[model samples]
Target chain A: MKIVAIDRQGKEHTLEGRDGWTVMEILRDGGLDIAAECGGACACATCHVYVNDGWFEKLPAPSESEIDMLDMALAVEPNSRLSCQIVCSETTDGIKVTVAPE
Target chain B: MTAAAPIETDVAIIGAGPIGLFAVFELGLLDLKCHLVDILDRPGGQCTELYPEKPIYDIPGLPIVTGQELTNRLLEQVKPFNPQFHFNEMATGLEKLADGRWKLSTDAGTTLIVPVVVIAGGAGSFVPKRPPIPGIEVFENAGDGVGVHYAVRKMENFRGKNILIAGGGDSALDWTINLAPLAKSLTLVHHRDGFRAAQHSVNQMRELEAAGKIKFHVASVKALHGEAGKLASVTLAGADKSEWHHETDAFLPFFGLTIKLGPIAEFGIHLNENLIPVDTAKFESQTLGIFAIGDINTYPGKLKLILSGFHEAALMSQAAFHIVRPNEKLRFQYTTSSSSLQKKLGVS
Candidate 1:
């Protein structure tokens, strides 16, 4: 599965990761600047990312707690989602996202 | 006399929670000495504060253990390291010293110069949650230090005064029982007759109330009245909203605690909301020589579990080793395989 992440610097990097691991794990393993503070528990908004327009709708809707955590994320947008809540799967192979500012 | 010199160490750890205590073992394995600072008067953090008797099931091999029991075992495991502990103080500032070592200062004026700083504070520092009493701040102790008090820093200050202690928590009950004889008259105020303190403490409080030594008011504090910032009387509202003025000299509200990012926010490290962001490999923040583990830190795919913090501590200690001793080579060894490490643990 290939997932692309644009860091705070706007430099894009494509990553190949296995299924079952979260988008957060793929991004961190791909050596990007993502802070999944609560470690995929949907407890913190550190792993927040702005999903590209086309990819945002394809992902599952965030839960109540995820939305609450997103409320605390800085620079939140309509497409903002906690990367840890986005698990890796076949449909999410070509997703694109931008890392939120620190 | 000149002020005492700041304490120095190889690693200055914040928070003596389970993760902080575990970091002592991991860092000790690498021969890195550590000094811990925490805001609470006691160690164990949430375990002791929130739930001491509640059984936890997910702590590795321990099938079913209470929070306090787990803390006790961890304390025993790390005892061989002899880590220095600074309790009842909050780490308030972090600055780069002239010699390249970091100088960390606490609220109590204790300072320590450490080459590597480890933050294991679980959800940051614990700050007491102030009750929602209108204008209570007005009587929160003025020039002579008498009126409203959150914590009894000095029990002697309330001697021979009419004291009104609110809330049903341990702090309220403990102080109610301890300060009964000291105060001219004491009143235990709560919304209901039930209390959250230990049974022994509650029973002791009841005994005092029965003997008419201390009055028990099944009510809540509504308003404070005083002159010159001195507490004169407190209006207690009953369940039916019936208010009555009770003559009191001092008011103490022990409403419990809420965690805050506190002074660590001033450390100049990158913060995601309130947690420190770190690299998964080293668990070190964007800043060099500073590591964050436990619930205090954030990374991609981070889990706030104690087991995860324990894993992070091991990796963080490895990364901290180089910064602490640049000239020495790091040789990884297992406790089961390395005899020297076993000797250090007093097991060999």
Candidate 2:
């Protein structure tokens, strides 16, 4: 599977994805600026991202804990989701997301 | 220069995280007095700050332990050592003294002089997350309560002013409820209508909103408008994508904190991609009398797990002892069988 991430500078990079890995792991491994400070524990919302409108519904809905964590994030929107909670899979191929501001 | 006298100790540890706390036990067994400095108000570092209630199953002896419980246990274990802790301070400066002792300085103006410095800073210090607003720095620290403020130091400073609080967490809701009565007008802006705060606080805020004592809006502050370090108003991006301006003398955003390497990067120690490189055998950094452990240190086959940090702390303490007591012969003894060691732990 493949993942596409847009940098804060508006540059897009195509990254390889692995099953069972989160989009956050892919972004960090792909040399993006994703902090992922909690190491995918979903305790911090630093891995926040805005999914492309087309890809928003394709990903699973955020859990209550994720939503609670998002309350601490800045500039949260209707499409904002914690990238660490979105696991990469065959169904999630070609997922596109924009890195949220710090 | 700090006007206060420098605190003298055998060893100075930078962080009070799990590893730093455990290092106290190991160093205390060797009769080394330690002083720890941490940015957070409490111990446990990220464990307490980020996820105090989260459970971990990997701690060796305990089957499962929450972050806060592990911190409590570590505190109890190190109580006999009487290691001093400087909380709510960030270690910002490091210099080698003429006497070969290291002098460490904090943003809080406290200083420490020690023979050995151990950096158990796990992933660095947790700092308040700044909103990505342009020119926001000009409005920050603007005479206490007239401009942008991250934390409310004194509620009275905000009294009788037009106040705007942002965030959906407890800090925002609690401040809104408390400051509404004091402010000439109080407005709370959040990205969504739902709040993550306690139900009681949220209900109280809603009651205030209903009584027209406060205004609640489901919007995000997109841009700040101010002049001469005084905030005049803020541009709000409504949930419907429409924008509007709201007047406020003070703006407070309660975005949660994120970790940063912070001033440790300027401590003259070499860093490998923001992590201090240390020898696996001694866990000592390139600088003599300086050591790095936990997630802040990088070595071949290094693991950032708390268990790995505990092992590193043991090895680091041994090297620290040599620096603290150069003329004393090192003696290794098991705590279970060594009377001297047990005495230090107050278990004999």
In terms of TM-score, the best-performing candidate is 2
Here, model 1's chain A TM-score works out at: 0.95
Candidates in order, interface RMSD in Å: 12.8, 0.9
**With candidate 1 superimposed using the best TM-score fit, by how many Å does residue B9's alpha carbon deviate from the native?**
1.3
Q: What is the lDDT of residue A102 in candidate 2?
A: 90
- DockQ, all models: 0.03, 0.79
| Clashing pairs for predicted structure model 1, backbone only | A36-B299, A36-B300, A39-B302, A39-B303
TM-score per candidate, in order? 0.72, 0.97
What are the fnat scores of the candidates, in the order listed? 0.00, 0.70
Instruction: Report the lDDT tens digits of candidate 1 across residue range B254-343.
Output: 765656778899899999978899999999998898899988898788877889999999999999999999999999999999998999
Q: Indicate the residue-level lDDT of A63 in model 2.
A: 96
> How does chain A of every candidate compare to the true chain A by TM-score?
0.95, 0.97
What tens-digit string does per-residue lDDT give for candidate 2 at B57-108? 9999999999899999999999999999999999999999999999999988
